[model samples]
Target: MSLHDPAQLMDERRRLEGLGLSVTRYGGAIGLIGLVLACLMGFIQENGMDRFFFVYLTNFIFFLSISLGALCFTGIQHVTRAGWSIVVRRLMELLAANVVLMAILFIPIIFGLHSLYHWTHAEAVAHDPILQHKAPYLNTAFFLFRAVIFFAVWIGLALFFLRKSTEQDESGDYKISIRLEKVSSWGLFLYAMTTTYASFDWLMSLDPHWYSTIYGVYFFAGSAVALFATLSALCIGLQKSGRLTRAITTEHYHDLGKFLFAFTIFWAYIAFSQYMLYWYANKPETTGWILRRQTAPMLWVSLSLIFCHFFLPFFGLLSRHIKRNKSLLFFWAIWMLVMHWVDIYWLVMPEYVHQYGEIGAAPFGLMDIFCLIGFGGLYAAGFAMWARGRSLIPMKDPRLAESLTFENA
Candidate 1:
């Protein structure tokens, strides 16, 4: 059968029964091992508990950002009614659904509240006027309430989209697509507000003395970069495993690479904008956050991000050939994913050092590795579980035809 034949596209390889089972088995095992070792390291090392919570939060946010990015793009494609993405939209839905798993993973951060947030200390709040001023929004009860609301919105949106998209697979109903487009319109608004406030509450409040109006956008930009990189990598991995080989063509990958490239610049733009504003203003509260990263070991990390995160990938992915070539695109995709982690590490690890009185010391260590592996393994397992018995592409999407034959102009 020809590769373009719709009748033969729904082959046995399009489903993930065997692949999903294997990924689930190994992914779950590795996750358990990583989590166990991370726990041991947390207790066995000095100030281990504190380090544990901070690193845990860092890894949690890193993975969470990927899902948030997936959710954002899923809504975006629907809102725009983009046809080029239908061939790969199922992967985005699968990734977005992992937000449920991320919610469960948030439990550790809740327990570490007192250790992670200086504002959580009653004594600190009493002494610091700034903390007192921010008290209403930063209090533990309100923080928890906001977290619940955030998760509720995310879970509801994720499940709704995933459920509806999957239903269309069985029902072959184009009206479901219309319903999704309608939901995505308002869903994006809720996503924007929740993501912004969540970033403020979870990350910005770590210091309690610093604030940035654009921090949420900064986070969103990096998440966008992560999302595109993830989708590209996953699609390549699936093709490599001999699944979705026909449905997801080079054209789909070309589009994914373009997104990855576009968002890499977007992330850099937002990052530099935030830094430039703070630098120009020279305000102590705002400058303090940037200063922490500019000093010592973190200073190197900061400089590296400018080059590694932006410049290197920016040039590497600039070629049209690179975007369509599976091997090259996969390399940049993995490269961007690593750089995205570094970006998150730079945002987070400085605070961990500043809090522990290890201002000059680099925070890199075995625990960071352990936490990353732990979270990563679980993330893979969740993705695999979601993929089980499901089509790797939206086999019946109204736009699938357009996507399958899509070509760049």
Candidate 2:
């Protein structure tokens, strides 16, 4: 803790002096191929751009959630001024920074807005009372305006913290930390508003007649948990590549595991709470959405989520011994990530399929995989490029010593 300990500080810096991260090499190729294939599949698909936009929306939210979750993670660290996460915070910063790229990626969704939301149809809005009632907020012009504002708020906050954090790594300015803390505190309220309304605009309005007050919070829960799994997997993979092998220790991974475990439960709680209240009230409008997921073949996916998303991880990650084990924890992290995808897929694909008087999983078909690969490849590549520009850890953070030497009791 002494300012006189120059040699000790230099040792820590040397450990993170080189981080081997190159996304453009292999990752760029994968992204290019996936997107091209997705485009080809889009053109080839039957009927309009409906199928293509539907696929895009599913994948768009999937990747966007992880980015926003990282934004939330960055905001939390800055606000709390937490010491334990300094070693791994840069990974999260890079993820949060991808919010810029996601906004650009969201352009296609903007062009295809009419394809995804029923309320955007003029004739349909004219005929349907519900759509008419919601028209003041759900009109295309206002929709695009909200989308732009949401991206601006998220991107601005994301860049500010990331920029300041990188600068502090160079200058070791203590004031930068204090400034980030203030920005992060104010930024949390902005994040909540943007994400909530954005979720309603993007996801909830898919079922035009359906409404749920907690849907945005539901989106937040899944997104945050997904980021935990992502960070855990990234750290393990980087360690395997001999990057940050010593810098990010098992203690950090254990905390990551704990978060993954905790939020898996939180996601389930929000999910069930939404369903339980809706089920009890028996409102035809809201209950229809849940029923579509609960009845027939769709119910199979719902049960699968209950087991995979909640129970499996719940019991599997319950032990402190399991949390501390690297390989076992990585396995569960992958499981939770897959389950999160399934969870979103269930939420989205059912409405798409119901248009044809059928409801189920992947019924809209395999373009889902293609778009996922496309966006996932692009998102990962952005993460790598961002990480390549800086130290793998926040090497000069005042709390770096605490994080590097962290222990879990």
Candidate 3:
């Protein structure tokens, strides 16, 4: 029953039988098929491919940023020499490992470049002084180069930390811990830099003329909240399945809930800060984006994000009792996960609605839900595929004892 008891550890491993890897495989296949069908539907429609690209990039950035945040969280844990998270660190590691899969998913975006990015077209660049001025940085070649670099840095970091962690599992060398701590400092810096620029390239550049200096931070906040939501779900799901119930406890779930609660506030803060700046400035270019959201159909989506994404969760998770209750935390976690989609949908879909004027549902286009399912299913598949056979906890981490015995003060 103790942390050091091998029998206790082995018993947790016994609970992880199959762990639903087949489900992921089938789900991923279905998601991939749905994505293909969605693309075909778009290509056949009037402005179909463009709409498809919009949905693709929206969901891509959503899931990609989630993995990036997970990777960043793992690196932060390593860099800080954290003790309580050792039990959940393997889950972070596996989620981060999905960055490799995300890099591959980006390939289709490259093919649909013109449809998504207006800057890719020379004539538009010629007419628009801003696009012309930003041509050097926003050009197709340079953009592709930066995307490759971002993925390379991200994937490299994911692989390095994963290998080291798994290596520690086999070797149990304390030096490996020290080594991870040493590298994570620089790794996190690299993560921040790459992610900031990547956000500009991928999401912010969708409207080349519109810009926000805090855009990257806003994206990071949303991503971090979504990732924390995912972590809560995974941890709770595993516990429900009778896995990691020993190494992980209600105390750990409480901490995860606290994180979910905290980052929900953080997302609202960044969102407001960004909006506050643009609203206060009242510049036509900047204000137009906000104006569009506040206008008609999108105004509703924006308002929903407030109550759904911010205020509701804020009050729902404010209590210590709620944070500690698995059912309540899981409910909020699932809620946020859906709201996270709504967040990104609000960010992307409104533009298309304004231009094309009512594509799918109110704010979201017709294909938007399919895109979400496609990406969610695929992301789950990636996380599950990597998680299979790996320890439900970091079984060999020396500090894992500390994690298993963690108690909140």
Candidate 4:
């Protein structure tokens, strides 16, 4: 169990066979019940279907961004030939692979397009010049096609990295690392472009007229924060459940906390950069999006993102002692995860409310909570499914030895 005994890592409890089975069963049940209840609430309430789709989209984007962030992080580690992360990379890979699950969840949003997006309406586009101008790119067919392409690329990259990484587990071949490095070099470029355009299609186009060149980066920053927080939380949870108790150490948690802290700042920077540009430009189309969020309720949500999302966490995570403390890191991890959802909700709900002419009304409701619980359960189920009968860490990764012996200077 000691770091000096690298050979003992091979004897670690790599598979989650016991705990994973229980999580999959209970998490799937909870997910299904939550989704069904949210559906019933949507039908029972007035204009509830509209609220359902927007709330669903908000939660959808929130979870999907986490997977997308995982994919990006996995690729970054591979391309950089990172050693400190081999102990944790498999967790990221599992999260990335759940993009396949996100693809399945996306079907509901397709059906809700008319409810969620203004540009999806043909008559409205015909009358509006801006929508007309953006029509070629925003039409239903093109939107779906782009989505398919995005998922295809993401799934392909996810499977390749995961398959090869797992293959290396058996073969213990260093060549597998070379192959992964080659793919990741170009894989990241594709990741950047697809995530950018996908965010544009899914989130930005909600407001057909508003545009920001940095919106994709904004999403990516938050996604990175989500991935690190989720990873930190997962590692802590796994250790608590008596899995990988020694293989993953305080050292790894410290590094995860540092990334969590770093990306928290990065997200705030991108958020402010986007906001500052809109404030400085004073452009009607872009400013309209910002102004809508400035109204009551949402204004409070916006303020929360400013303080809770950034300032509060910035100071809370400033100390090395805090990052190194497992208990403290777990708290910050959970905190960042909640803030990331608020950030996604802030990005999405304003447009949904603006469409209903209820700019003053806060869109927070039971349905949002239900949808979040639904997605959270399903996310847990999918991750557990991928994790079952598999090593919690990449047991045979070439750099795993380095990770096992890694220390912060």
The models' CA-based lDDT, in order, is: 0.90, 0.82, 0.84, 0.91
| Top of the candidates by lDDT | 4
Clash pairs detected, candidate 4? none
Please give, for residues 313-394, the per-residue lDDT of candidate 2 as tens digits.
Answer: 9999999889889899999988988888888888787877765464334464556677788888788778777666576666
Question: Candidate 4 has what TM-score?
Answer: 0.98
TM-score ranking from best to worst?
Answer: 4, 1, 3, 2
User: Model 4 over residues 106-188: C-alpha lDDT tens digits?
Assistant: 99998899999999888898899988888888899989999999999999999898889988888999999999999999999
For every model shown, what is its TM-score relative to the native structure?
Answer: 0.98, 0.94, 0.95, 0.98
For residues 309-391, could you state the per-residue lDDT of candidate 3 as single tens digits? 99999999999899888888889999998898788878777766665566445645557777777887898888887776666
**Could you tell which candidate, 2 or 4, scores higher by TM-score?**
4
Residue 66 error, candidate 4, Å:
1.0
Worst 10 residues of 1 by lDDT: 1-10
Clash totals, every prediction: 0, 0, 3, 0
Q: If candidate 3 were superposed on the true structure by all CA atoms, what would the RMSD be?
A: 1.8
Cα-based lDDT at residue 338, candidate 1: 93
Candidate 4 Cα misplacement greater than 4 A, ranges: 359-361
